[model samples]
Target: MTATGERNALDPEPIQSRLRALLDHHPDGPLPDAALRQIRTSIAPDHRSRPPSTGTLKERAQRHEAESAAARAELIESIHAVDPTPEGLLEFGRHVRRNVEPSGFASNMGAAEFAMAPGAIRAAAEHLLDTGTSLAEICIGLNLLSLAPRDGDSERIRIFIPLGRRIEGTAIKALGRIGRAGPHLAWAAERTPVYRRLGAVQAIWDLPEREFSELLYALPVKQSADLVQMFSALDSRPEGLQGDRRFARILRDAARPGALEAEPEALALAAQLWDEVRYGRCALLGFAPGEREMTTAGFQALLASPEASASVDAALAATPEDPDLVWLRMRLNRAAHSDPPLPRGLAVRVSVPRPSIATQARTHLLLDGVPLVEAHFQRGHSGRPETVLHDGRGLEALAEPRDVKIGDTGCVEECCGAFRAVISRRGGLVEWEVRDTVLKDPPTTRLTFDADQYDAEVVRAAADFDWEWPARRAARLLRERIGAESELMSRWECELAWTGSWSPDRSEMQYSFYYPKRPSGNDAYVQFSAARDVPYVPEVDDGAVMAVVDRIIADLRTTDPKSTARLSGGSREYAEALGFPWPP
Candidate 1:
């Protein structure tokens, strides 16, 4: 019962009765809309209201896992104690069918545990797998085979692989576990639907390169999204498909003229393939040169078809700003103009796009006026925008001889993806080599720039901030005025810092001298804000803000003698003074 004296929705008996009543009324067809609404309303509130436990989510999860472990141990012990007879095994299968829900938690015995089981028990499991009519018994048998994989059981498991969705995944897993299942797994990958072929593709990675290449070519292309997982699996292999002529031939065939028609799915796949080559996935760079040009030409041929082009244009007209569609349109425009291929020169330039409500100030890197990062990396999935160097020391940092993050997923929290490069100077040349990356199988990208040209470009980019927002201007002026080793810095124990405003229309220019080691709830820093309309020129507005900061800090010091002492003292004294009240 709930606190309101109403029946708890989680009470399975009542919920089951309600479901039975509904099913009886609509026995052979879909339920009416009203019936569906009734069903939802009956259970949604209680499910929402019930917290798993009166503890933090982490604590609750830990407790549940511990309980599950204890339960599994007890069940395993009980199974070990069961009599080792044909009758006993049959009774155990019956017990499982009666008590176990197909989707519910159950103890799965591992290889070592099954090895310790009586020989009679293992024989019974195989017998159940061979002839059991019950889905539960078959699923149990499949799991046992996978854990204690036997070469002899491979053929038996293969029979169940194509049976149905109910046990197909389990059967596939078991077959993959047995020795020498690569050929069978590859066959399955070719026959299964694209969505269900991930496991099969992963299992066949150890196959010979020729066989793997044949498998990839034989699989039918459906939607572009379907190929992402397949390409990902290929990229994850240690040796990769580098310099394999068979794989190169496969790519060449795929890129051949008139191979891909003007269908929407084909066009999307073309774009994905182009992206794959650009990002260097699947060891694409190991292939002969000019394959990229051939692929692009193939995609362009599809675009040249009047009917296909019209369809894509109509889609864009209806949903003009869909990122993927927009990206496709951009690529088409570039292709139509025959934009010069990625420049192989030493010159570097930075391009800044106008700011908008949805996007903040971003900078794009260009080599000889051709976009570098934009042409290479994928913009992350929807809602998470592509990351680029923003207004900061990001560009200047590139000049240093260290691995620097050139781009990333547009996340300020934990990074989901990043592209990094090592910049080094050797003699008269500056080398930019891809060191670590988020790409699956990125191509080798190493470029050498004349040392003088590279240094000049870095200096030019860092100094040229004509696109700075008012907040950026304010922060820059503050940092300049309050020198790195100023008395103000020592007193406040902070450095001048600012992250530009996210909003474009209304700039809340915030400048702060932040204390690096301030305690929680201790607002021990000085902050200033400027509005969008404020004068952005450093010479015009710098003096006024600096004056205000000086006055405020002077007032704070005079009023809080103890706080000043704590700030000046060493770590031990600061620790001793933590609990006492301090002036802001």
Candidate 2:
């Protein structure tokens, strides 16, 4: 009021002069007493102070900031009195709220403070890992230590589990030092010693069946103790794995001979698993069906269909207790009434036809009426082109070998290759065929049968074309056989060492080196590494192992297929170390 010559309602000074100034400025008289009281209450306390600061608002703000900074400095010094270990920091963080509330001070802290002392943090983390405190708890402690926002616990775990090299500003960075030694270093640092020992075993969960066989030769006998412990921990098991035979096979592979003989729980699990696999596989592979347990009415109704009744009768005659019978019945019933997806169209188209007249002649392939690829022949020949059928769209197609005319010429004919389906780079399906001949290209034909026939054939082909399951089965069988027969010949332990990056097309190469435990032999124990294109995988029951085993036996059989003699020679025991009960 004094400086601007305006009325100030909250002012303690007399308002007569201000009221006169207001009257001069406005034709209306002074505000009413009720309105004046409200205006005084609405005015800010600082604005109505006895006298405003002689300095401007900016200068006063700077002075207040300086005073707040001094108070915050004192608060930080008190916080620093607390020890900086994980537990200490946790307690300090709790106390910070009381200090902040009383001082009316607020400040943001750097999240990196948690990682300031790597040694202390590492020690604390080691203690936590040993105690089985999960990564989630560790992250929460870290956030509190660093005074960072504590949110996204699940997101932090997801990011930490799959972290690779090149982690920066991430919780993983604070967990361990970024050494060039594989990205798994952090994972190892954060797990129990038992879990650390089984890191390679856990890889089985991610690897494809073909690579699973690598586990046979990879694990050392020294690690068996830890592996057995892990199996014992899993004895209670999950409900979903009630009839899962593959899991049983894994347990058996981990346990040494006579190891689980005393473990009744493990033994029971193994027996149940064996029954499930032996009979269930037979049912799934269409080898045969077993008996059914049904009410009288159900049995009579089943008898109404001669085929179903015959199937049931055959199952009854096959085994006294067919463990897979229940599962098979359920699956068959579901399949009979299932509504599955159909191929909307073919996946691939032929860029060009094979077997040009002047150029080398060959054939082209198509899937679902669409052309996929062309195969060029080394040399041209004359005859009617080979008969090719698109059949129809499906998950898979079987190649039927057929005698085909070489070209337009009738004089010569050759056995043509089979057709199969594959995915293209553009996420489309493509049909492929092996071109073993130098003759004319194979003919491409669309589905010729009626809609009903086409649908039936397509569904039938799809039904029998589950390659993934077969691969898993073969893996399991190989692991079981290998686990039963294979042993460390050398007394010393062997280590599984990875040689290169992971690749989908080829197996990862792993080599094992063991020093002779016997004093008499200076010979080195060297296990064969994977072939150039093969990857290492843990053994499981699957069809992928079947193909791998077939290849192994085929290569070995080149010399002697009938001989049950295992591959025994040199300081290293060859394929015989994992030979099956019967000749390949």
Candidate 3:
């Protein structure tokens, strides 16, 4: 019987008799066999020695509580041993597993241990960063090192790349489910130097030659030029270029001509770049008053130094001029215009007369005296608006972001372009895109379309567009041009520096900086899938490519009756129709 039961039984007796019997122990049992058995059980060695049944609610709960306390204590103690404190939990865990796991103790420690000491982990990271200490030494010293975890051999692998100025080889090695392109690369980008250099080069190498040319001028002149040479050696070959033609052209621009009559060739090179230009910034050379096009005057200034012999102007003006340069200049000028130049921020309204047929609608966005984004828009009718009543009849009460339409059709136009698209049940969406980067803004400029206003015919004069580069377009062209795998890798170096990240899902019909994430800074890679085929891009001057993209963008932006020719948004269809050789 329980102590309570015994007490209750005693209470049933008279107070005097119960007290006397409890004190004497003789009257309590009364010598009955059953009573004797109960007494014997209470005092028996076997029964006394047995553990408590623990079946009662309080006893069971107490047992569980004791066990839980023990578990918590173990976890806390374990955490204190390996990581006495913690700041970044996952990072701390990584450090501990990497440094401490080799010792015999850490493997034995439980999860609660990791949960206990947050400060210790932070200390470890600081120590790791500050002291060039070996993690293995720390683990062994802490008595945490031991054999690897059961499956750790399969799940984990070491990375050998160094960052900053100290690192040597940085080839990414594959492990488990992760490829050589490890996730650590993403994290390394923040703290490691190895990745930053690779990423910068990746951005530019992938773009077109003209943009790359402009990019060189924008890059830290010395450092940027060195990177460009490295890229040339790696990507393509040109005159005196060890790699290929694109890099050769870049090197040619970077060079200061030797003394004598090299003036004409230098001027020719300048003209080629000026005509084919695309995207790039020239903060390196300072600014220009007009749209910074290369001119004969500029050429004269460059070649007028004391070392130069013969009049640069006379050599260039010689009747038997370099036919190759002349042809290049002509081609670039033609590429610079659309049927009519695009207009920017110029909104006009016209309801679809049929309200169902889709026609090409166009617009231009201007920036820095140039049309930036231009394309055909799709237009359609919008539905009527309404409002929700307070009555909880139609809508659910728990839902968020309440939606209601009101019955009003205001003529107010939104900054959001709803008028660009005139949709129908039959045709699909048509959007504006940057086909060329050369046209002056406000869409249809008299200068952009007035072929008669030019001092010379298209074939004779170098295009008047700015020759500065745009890196993104260069990347597109490079990817299209080179067939070599290694060259392909280097193409993105410049582009990555400009755009920040890379994306493979580019639309053939559309062109823009189409990265997967809006980068804090660009990260271009030289690798591509084996199945992809990069088209052959030509070796036109960097300025000429820019001029072409610009002209094409501007020329496609108008709906005027004067439209004689236009480049299509789906450039492939246009190319097929025109049968013109694509710019490599």
Candidate 4:
């Protein structure tokens, strides 16, 4: 104040007096006096500690990376203490999985930590393989290698551990033992762990000739589908799983009289399925082939397959009427334009109510969402419900409907005038006409039906004739071979008759067997019936049909010695004409 004449800014007495006056002016202010008194103490340099301003984003990221790197360094150092033995490797895998970042890419902490130290990883894997370590341990080692960042040939590592990890010496020896242990794979499947068992099964195609033959014989028919899947997974090139030599061997073994006699339908289906898969076709048969047809070279290769003859023989003996099998037979014979043009997206529906003592009933037939025909019938008290038709309203609507009978029961109902149906295509428009006045009722009943209807009828008849045999066989197979849970069941009634039939207007098969508890003579014999209004497929030789009859008769004989075998009443005369021994 004396030197510059400025107000005495450092004067404490004046400063205190000014503050007191200001505070007194605002005594009822927001803050209480006690709060004001403690403000200086609360905000003193010693007490004030708000965080300082953060650095730039790049700077902050750099700091985080450094810290993470240090932490990872510490983790790796700790993991290194674990020995590179099988047990140690498992522990390391656990550690890596636990620490792996969500993004899978972290400079400081990531699966790359394992890749950086391949020495330990490889050593542990080799040690596990050398030692007869458990499959789980080997899997853990392989998983670690798979997950590690790929610095080099990651595929090589995978090859070393194969999906089943069966490359180990012990595993290989065990697999060899399985091949020598006869055809039944159940034992091997049970003895080994899941992965090792699967590995052994996959090696079936590569087994020696004798071993392969044994395996096929021992392979359960129920497991045939599974075997096909495994075989399909193998190499499918011409020289691959379907090569001439191997396919021939498989066909010969499967077609052997013994194999066929044991599981006729299953073995045939398996062989056919194998061929289909080898040819790059779906395993399921009956459907039309896709757009891509095989080239001449591929066709020639199929022709040259050693098993071609055997497969044909089996088809004839097993399922001759199967459209797919019949077509396969013709194709193998180098027949021209043998493939049938099966309609796509065709669905068949049949509504048959549970039969009672009623005298009259009706059955409706639908094909691909369109009503084709209805069969109204009045069965004599003792006879089967006879199907009859009157006006051809539904038939005329079809592309080409033939054979219009008001009440035709396939058999000679009354030669007054049998019916005939004509189906044809004109300018891509299908026409079906049923003629009720066709004079020519052939001396023998020659029915014409579509391929689907024919195939469905055959299947239905086979299922119905001696039905108990299949049911028993399936139950036994499930119990003895597969060890499936199957308890004994009881029958409450005597089976009498079954309805196995089909209609030309629909591609559906109908089957139902009658069972009655009463000892009435009405339920005396097993009556099976089937109707056909379509022509039998030309691709299938008559021999196949004979084989099916023989099998049915054999089953009937086994099931009931005194009973007469009548498969599809319409076919009885045909069976007799062919010397099929069906009535026996």
lDDT of 3: 0.28
Model 4 segments more than 4 A misplaced: 1-79, 84-116, 146-297, 304-584
TM-score of each: 0.45, 0.20, 0.21, 0.25
Ranking by TM-score: 1, 4, 3, 2
Candidate 4 lDDT for residue 522: 35
lDDT of 4 at 355: 14
Winner by TM-score: 1
> lDDT tens string, model 3, 101-153?
22223223333445433345444423322221232222221222111122331
lDDT of predicted model 1: 0.48
Q: Which candidate is the best by lDDT?
A: 1
Once fitted onto the true fold, the runs of candidate 1 whose alpha carbons sit more than 4 angstroms away are: 1-172, 175-201, 204-214, 221-229, 232-238, 303-307, 314-330, 345-388, 395-403, 407-428, 431-447, 451-584
Q: In terms of TM-score, how similar is model 4 to the real structure? A: 0.25
Taking the tens digit of each residue's C-alpha lDDT, what string does model 2 give over 1-584?
A: 33332223553332223333433454321133333333234321232434556588899989778877876666446444656455664444344422332223321324343333544443333332222122222332332322322233222222222221111122333322222212232223222222122232243223344443343234432233223223222312222223334433343343334333322223222222222222211111111122111111122232233454345446646742332332233223332342242233432111101101011112222233222221122122222111222123222333342333222221232444333223112122223333434335644432222333334544553343231222323333343443343332221232222122121211322222222221235443333233322322322234544566556434433432223223222232322343323223
Question: Least accurate stretch of 10 residues (summed lDDT) in model 4?
Answer: 374-383
Q: All candidates: CA RMSD in angstroms? A: 13.8, 33.3, 32.1, 32.5
The C-alpha local distance difference test score for the whole of candidate 4 amounts to: 0.35
> What's the CA error at residue 179 for candidate 1, in Å?
8.6
Predicted candidate 4 versus true structure: per-residue lDDT over 1-584, tens digit per residue: 32332223452222123334444564421122233333223222231453553799999889768866675565556445657655575455445434422121211223445544766655544433332123333333343333332443232232221222222222333334323523323333322222234444555555676876666656654344335434432322112432333333343344333333222234334433333432221212222243112322233343335455576667667766543344344344542223232233222221221111011223222233222321112111011122222132322324454444432333464644433335443443443444444245432222234555434532432233221112222222222321121111013223323222222111222232222222355333233433222223423233443444344434433463223333433244444553434554
**Full-model lDDT for every candidate:** 0.48, 0.30, 0.28, 0.35
